[model samples]
Target: MRPVLIALPVLALAFLAGGLALTRPVTVPDTALAGLTGDAIAGEAVFWAAGCASCHAAEGATGAARLVLAGGQRFASEFGTFIAPNISMHPEQGIGAWSFADFVTAVQEGTSPEGRHYYPAFPYGAYRLAARQDLADLWAFWQTLPSADTPSAPHEIGFPFSIRRAVGAWNLLNLHDDFVVTGELTEAETRGRYLAEALAHCAECHTPRDALGGLDRRAWMAGAPNPSGSGTIPALTPDRLTWSEAEIAAYLNDGFTPDFDSAGGHMVSVIRNIAMLGDEDRLAIAAYLKALPPAGD
Candidate 1:
């Protein structure tokens, strides 16, 4: 019995070591963003598409103020409440010192500049599929945005979940770079897929999650309970949202439904950001939503 008890501790230590090795912070190559000239002008479109302002900007900020990226928004989830960090260009309080490689690593690999794993609330899982060139453009545009002195708020996670390194393991289970909508698609549909799956990260909110907090891809765009615990996010699937393609595009553009009801809640911000996109882009999103098979209740 003494020998068996001694071996149990050894086995536990071995298991922990293995887990650490498997979940080590893995970042992209340092040269991933090298040689790509950043275009701040072109990046404006990517900024809107990526919805960077939706979460990072000061809550209730409107119009031009949304570009500040002060990042005090709080997101409540089953695990805990996650706070958006300040990503402005402030030399002391924000990411002003982050290199282009740091930006790529954070967005594509979910690894922080300090080699720590970022919480999934940042939506790196969806941002991972973004085009490298577009990311470079975003970096340029980010530099052009106004800097802020706002300090980032810490997450409200508890216990073992507070350990940031543990997020490495979570990323292993949830981070997927593949396109959710596949098979042959029209040019517009393909663009829409990129916008939906990668830039806008629609599934991050629209899709349901499993027990471990990983997205349930099987359900796709079927709506889920808002992580904020308020109400269900409406499903984009044909089963629930039967809006015609034109209606969908118009709603996205004008933020008004055919019933003349105006957009409300977080969708108001989403519509504002998406409205910055070209008319064709809105139509493309409608096309992609129209093509989806019914999923989830």
Candidate 2:
């Protein structure tokens, strides 16, 4: 019994050490920000492509009001309610004081300037796949937006979910910076893949997650229950969509189906964001969706 007790404590210590290692933050290389030059005009397009306003902007805001990224939007999940932080240009209430490296770390590595791990709710896993040039341009454009003095609300998460270090372990299993599909894709397909997988982060919503919240890549783009636990998010696989390429593009651009059905729910904002893209981009996205292998419900 004495020997067994000693061995048990040793095993417990070892387990604790392993968990700490798994949660360790990755180092951000200084070269990530080197030689980065950004254009505010170009950044505006990147901003829309990344769909920043969808989460950061005020709910139901329209026209010029949509540009205010004060971030009071609440996202409820099985974990708990997460309040979006203020990302506006305000020096105190927002990220105005952050440096280029800080932004890069937050977006790509899911680490804050103070070296805290961000919850996966921030979607850095997808943003990690974004091109460095695009991130630079997006940051530049974000700087041009007007600042708001709104303060951010704290997230209402509890217990295990509230422990940010636990998220590092989750990242170990789920986080990666690679494109979902591999092969010699055409130019349009490649562009669409980047837009869909990286910038737009479509899988963050469309693809169902395992119990641990990791995306089920085997069932890629197969619709899942809304993360909000409200309604079913429709599948976008070719088997389910069945729309012609033109119809797909039209739906993305105008939010209207060939049957004259209008988009609703979360898709309304998604359509609005994609509509900001050029016609070619819309067509490319449609082409990519049509080319994908179908997954069943």
Which candidate's TM-score is highest? 1
Which pairs in model 2 have colliding backbones? none
What lDDT, from 0 to 1, does candidate 2 have?
0.82
lDDT of 2 by residue, 1-297 (tens): 232343443345435745668667765676857999988888887888888888888987666777899999999877678998888999899988888788889888899888988877888898899888898899899899989999999999866566676666677778877888767888998988888888888888889887667899988888899877678888888999889988989999999998999998777887878898999998988877876768865
lDDT for every model?
A: 0.86, 0.82
For residues 51-99, write the lDDT of model 1, one tens digit per residue.
Answer: 9999999887889999999899998876678999999999788999988
Relative to the true structure, candidate 1 has a C-alpha RMSD (angstroms) of: 5.2
TM-score of 2: 0.92
TM-score of each: 0.92, 0.92
RMSD of 2: 5.4
